[model samples]
Target: MYLGSQEMRTVLERDNGTIQKNLKKLTFYYGASDLWCPVQYYEDIKKDFPSGDIRLCKKGIQHAFVTSLTSSREMAAMIRDWLKDDLAEM
Candidate 1:
């Protein structure tokens, strides 16, 4: 999902408890360098959902996966390989 600045602000608010609770999983494709949410955010989120699954995909760029990835073929191949590991428990 493409989250705009306004939407992110809404999600970060404590009053949006229902929305926050429903977001059990978070996937970040950082492209290896882009620290979008920062390390402290990751640490804080982990503390809240200690056992929740957080998927991170680091590709061939520094925080520019969405823009730098020239071919979807490589991404598809990577995903297929990653899913084979059976990450259902995490």
Candidate 2:
């Protein structure tokens, strides 16, 4: 069950062209902080999908924000708001 670098890249890397082609039909809300995963990844995604909702937490929230009840609630609220706004547009 251990996937090495190539396997991981194959599983994770998206074809930018394909994603761009379908971008109009997709709704995304991506959040990333500099604490765990690289902030540049999210930035790149924002660049690729300019219309997509992406939140970069400069305050350095941990990657495992859901481990605490308070953080989980905050995350849920954020998602709920995003969902509401997305639904309103459709």
Candidate 3:
């Protein structure tokens, strides 16, 4: 399957009030060396949306993390942990 080499879509902007209202509830995770998204993209979004939970993978995982069983397991566990608190309150 083709992955990480396509051009990005056009940018979309919403009202500041709407963005701020939903920012805190969103979680954005990017691969440390993802080819699909450059570091600049992460930085830009982080600077624009400081209130959101934006995280970069520090485990050296790449864009195709699903190709590796170990990475898949680690990523899945990390996501589970991230959502554990929310699940508990549900």
Scored by Cα lDDT, where does model 1 land?
0.52
Query: Tens-digit lDDT track for model 3 on 1-90?
Result: 233223223334434586678886788888778876788777877898887788877889878779999989998998899899768978
Off by over 4 Å in 3: 1-21, 88-90
How many clashing residue pairs are found in candidate 1? 2
Model 3: lDDT equals 0.77
What TM value does model 2 have? Answer: 0.63
lDDT value for model 2: 0.67
Q: Which model, 2 or 3, shows the larger TM-score? A: 3
TM-scores for all candidates: the values are 0.47, 0.63, 0.72
- Cα lDDT listed for each candidate: 0.52, 0.67, 0.77
Look at candidate 1 and give me any clashing residue pairs. Answer: 33-63, 34-63
Per-residue lDDT of model 1, residues 1-90, tens digit only: 456676877766433355266655434332333456565655565566566554444454444434545646576666676666547645
List all candidate RMSDs to the true structure: 5.1, 3.5, 3.5
Error of 1 at 41 (Å): 0.9
Which prediction has the highest lDDT against the true structure?
A: 3
TM-score-wise, the better of 1 and 3 is: 3
- In model 3, what lDDT does residue 2 have? 32
